[model samples]
Target: MTILLALDDTDSLESRGTGRLARAVADAIAKHYPIWGVTRHQLYVHPSIPYTSHNSCAVIHIDADGGEPLNTALSIAEKTMLDDFVEGSDPGLAGATLDQVAPAVIAFGRDAQQMVLTQERARTLAANLGIWLKGLGGTQDGVIGAMAGLGLAATRNDGRFLQKGTIRSLTGPTPAELLLGAGVDEIMTLDGRRVTEGTIILKEGKAAKACPINGRVVLFVDEQDGKLVAVKRN
Candidate 1:
């Protein structure tokens, strides 16, 4: 009955929003089930995202941006098939059915520039976890719902590098991989539409296109192939 809240970073909405939501869900579960512990992890897309842990009976992935956090949350809920209510039972007891209890909450966010979860992948996660679905709505109330959202009420950052041309690409490996290989950099995205050099001030994957700035530096480039790939900054 431990709840793991894996976040990308402390700066993003996943940290603030999903962190709050995890707290709320933990609160509700505490009332009926004995929560073992709640943990959070910052995630990155490079080196490939880690599969939800085996210890996690349920997981929630929240994108740094808006829409996907809710969508991912709902997908996890559905996969876990979390019950809204459980009969008087000790969740800590062996062989205890996780009735109305979400075993884990996998909250996602940004590490460098990579978006970790995808819509199709989220739906697949739900199928794997075996939980019900519910969106984590926007607002304080929605935050509360994200925590409590399992029942029904459950409503539910990083840096720069360089720019080349209209199609600027990192001249190395993927951001995350580059970090492992080299270190870090102050790489920024160049506006293709405006042709202005701008850094990513704010970002969210689901809302990437809608961001005021042009394309973000979610991936690096293969200096050889001239293709976008993951890279470490610096």
Candidate 2:
């Protein structure tokens, strides 16, 4: 069973405190389920880009000081997840908006037997509608319990530890799958080795003309014409 803890903009700007509130809610959900993985994405609103993520059983949306649109976006995400459950596939509705159909989406997820939401998701929706989390079987105490037992603390102010969980690095052909938030341009081969760089490398069955003895190898390309301009050895 999995639960998707999704966040939307409903709480007032002064009270929305995402990181703190998210952590608190995550803590509570850990009591009933074990979170397996987390993936983050960027939501493009008219002028703002908010951060969002999907955990084993929850989805999280974090944004800046925006209100109505945030709520609308959250509703869309919830609906998307529910749609996936219904279809039994990767619901290709990640970036779509469905504000008018939010209530129906919530009801669907609630009825799914294999999925559950963290107290945070339930509480945020309830608060927006002047309802109570307890009425939905979601509560702050549950979140606190999950966080404490799982050792999932709120992210710190310093930009050191942005990722959660023990699996910190990636190993495979598509490194992009691991560093979804990192703006990596491309991956290339240097000295018969594969390395990630800011540009793609093109070769004509010949050794690289200029190779660096230290650091990594990267192929720099022309911005306008998309041509391989230089081979940079860093």
Name model 2 segments beyond 4 Å from true.
Answer: 47-163, 166-234
TM-scores vs. true structure, each candidate: 0.26, 0.25
For candidate 1, give the lDDT. 0.26
lDDT of 1 at 65: 31
TM-score of 2: 0.25
lDDT of 2 at 48: 22
lDDT of 2 by residue, 81-188 (tens): 332232112211121122322453344333322243344553454445432122111222222122111111111101112123332332222232233233222333
Best by TM-score: 1
* Model 2 error, position 55 (Å): 19
How far does residue 147 in candidate 1 sit from its true spot (Å)?
Answer: 15
lDDT tens digits by residue: candidate 1, 73-185: 33443332223212221011001112323333223122112353443433333445554323322111111112221211111112222211111222322233333223222
Q: lDDT of each structure?
A: 0.26, 0.29
